[model samples]
Structure formats: C-alpha cells, structure tokens
Target: MSEKFEIRREVVVPGTPEQIWAAISAETAGWMFPSPLEIPADGSRPDSPIIADWEPPRELAIHMQGPDGWFNNLEYVVEARDESTAVVRYVHAGVFAEDWDNQYDGASKHTDFYLHSLGQYVQYFAGRPVTYVSAEGPEASSAPEAMGALRGALGIASGATAGDTVTVDVPGIGTVEAIIDYIDDWFVGLRTENALLRFYGRNAFGGNVDAAHHLFAADADGDAATAAWQAWLSGVFA
Candidate 1:
C-alpha cells in the first residue's frame, strides 16, 4: 500500500471563489512561493509525465513524477460554504521507499509554503484599506510643490501634460488607470476609479470593486505606486 499524507487548512478571505481561482491559476509560479519552480528557459510548462484533473470551484488533482523516480499524486480541493470562508485540502500519495522520507519532507515544506502564501495572497488581493499622506497640509503654501515632488517620486514625468492617464500594472492582479486627478500645493491624488472600473470588466464584473479598491488603496503610496503599477502590468501581460 502507498503511504498517504493530507494537510488541510481553512482561510477566511474577503473575496469570492472566482478571485481565489484567479490567484492560483496565475501564470507566475512564484505567486505561490518565494522562488518559482524552474521550468524550460522558454517558459513552457515542462513536459513532465504529469496529468491534471480540474473541476472549478471544487477540486484539482495531479499525478506526476517525484524525485528519485518516484511517482506522486497530489490533490487540491476547495470547499466554499459562503462568500467569506473556504476550506482547502492538499493530499499526497506515493509508494513507500527508503528515500520516501526525504521526498515527503521536501514536498510537505513546499506545499505548506504554497498554501499559506496563497491564503495571504487571496486576502490581500481581496481588498485592504490603505492611507496616503503628504508632506504638506492641504492649505500649506508649498502644497503644490510637495505634490510635484510626490508625482515625481511616483515616476510621473515632471513634464507630463494634464489629462494624461498612466496605466498602473500589477502581477496576479490587473492593470489600473492612474489619472493625474490634480496636482496642488498640498497633495497629489491619482484617480484610479477608472482603472478599478476596467478591472471589473475583465473579471467578468465579479462585483468585487471593494477588493480591487483595497488593492489599489494598499498600493497607492509614494514610490510604491510605481512598483504596484509594474506588477499589475506583468500580471496582465503574463
């Protein structure tokens, strides 16, 4: 008989089933881990003798080769009871062997990291509140100058003409439009409502702008906005 191990975890997220799926199914492997699996240099899913079985919002199964010529079976199942909670289970099976212990340890570590990271990612992408601060107060005499500095820090060109909107891209997330709403002496507030609106369109209008808004809010800080923008672009283009 094959040795079996199962790990189950429940994560409460402020997102829907669709949102969870999007994160897991993202093209970038690192979304689930700090270091992604190395595949072909051409970026193709390896032609390993692995098979996948997927049933959306429910289950996914894979049978693949393990280290030392071992064969392993892995299954991931999602059970959603409501809009805010889900139980995910990961199960592994393989034949027992002298090297089985090592394989199991490595697999367990990687899978655990993947699951934990995924949960955190889902929660984060599901909208989190963020705050912005300016060096000068709204009524300060140098507010406009401070706003210019803020915009420049965010990589918005100092000479960028008015009415120009820049696409802020994020990976595993999508692109958001950052309209230079207004640059005053006190602060610069980039309007991303349109970007949020556009995201809704691609996500089948999942009716979760609250989550998207949270994502933008968390990212709409100082130079961080530029990094967030680039991440969104990579996710979209990837």
Candidate 2:
C-alpha cells in the first residue's frame, strides 16, 4: 500500500528573489545536488512533463507521476522580504510504498539541512563558481558510532555548535580553520574561507555516511578533492 505525505518548510535566505532563483534553478551544486536542469527561457514550458509551473524569481513547481498512481511534487515560492533578503516556502509532497514511516522521517529531516545549506550558500558564497566533490564512506559507516568517529577525525567536538571556530584536518589534504555553519544530529556543515563542507551521518537512516565539498576557490581542483575525501572516508570507516 502506498501512503501520501507532505513536508512544508520556510526559510529566510539572505539574498534577493533574483539571487535565490538563480541559486535554486541554476547553481544548485553550491548547496544541493548537482543535477543540472534546463529551464525554459521563453514563455513556453519546459519539454519535460515534470515541470508543472515555472514562474521565474517567484514560483517553480515540479510534479512527477508514476504509472502506479504514485506521485511526487516539489514546489518552491520565493518572496522578497527586502532588497537583499527573501523568504522561501518549500513544499514536498509525495507517496511512499513500504516502510513509509522511515522514508518520511528521513525526507523531512533532509529538507531541514538542505534548506539551511541553501541559505548559507546565498549568504556567504552567492554567485561564486563551485567545485563539488562527493564521496561515500565504507559499509562500516552504517554503524551508529560512525558520525562521532567522522567528527572526531575532523577535530570537531561532539558538542560543537554553529558559529564556533575550529581547525579541521582533512586527511590527504591539509588543515584549514573553519566555522561551524550548521550542526544537527544527522548533518554537520562547515564553512571555510574557500569552501562549504557537508558531512552526512546517514547511518541513522540505514545508509553509509557521506561527505561533500563545495569548493569556491578560484583554482579549485574537484578531482583532487574527490580523491582526498575518498581516502579520508575509507580511513574513517576502515
């Protein structure tokens, strides 16, 4: 049996409507996953049937319907709060099959972290080019202690909170001072001079942990970063 669910969240981003739209629509790699989307420029709708609505700088909606009567919809409404700020209302509605409770739980929590990262991107690194590198830890990361181990390896205290300054040593890379931009039971976000780093303790959701680096440095090397993080993750889970 399939069950329907809806998740709603509101976030205040430190960017204008235009900037927020660009970040969500085009520069998603900076905050979210790098799934490049081709939004229609003309008044016409995009070729993909998934796009239910497209009003740039204001509203964008996506609807995907499966043949088995299951569907998923994601909508974002961006409203100007001031000349340099905006409020975003996000809605994610979908249907889940088996283990729907766990699915819903994970999805809802993920929205919190992702949206926070979006706000961080708009506030700190708006309009900057990014090199995104991601790596997943070994199967041992499924253990409950994986998050603590990863944080320990990064030199971040278990009780660290946002706004605290700390120096992180990236194995195979070098040490860099950073501020804790966000932290929660399942996610940790770090902001450095040239990068935004995210660590996902996904073992709570029955998955291996993962790490991503969104490097905004002028001479960022995505390939090198990927290799270094992969090695680090392996070491942490080994």
Model 1 quality (TM-score): 0.39
Q: Whose lDDT is greatest here?
A: 2
RMSD (CA, Å), candidate 1 to true, equals 16.9
Per-candidate TM equals: 0.39, 0.94
Number of the predicted model whose TM-score against the real structure is largest = 2
As a whole number from 0 to 100, the lDDT of residue 15 in candidate 2 is: 93
- Can you write out model 1's per-residue Cα lDDT over 85-199, one digit (the tens) per residue? 6766667766656555655554554455445445645654333333322111122222224334334434567667536777644443456467654333222334454222111
- Each candidate: RMSD to true structure? 16.9, 1.8
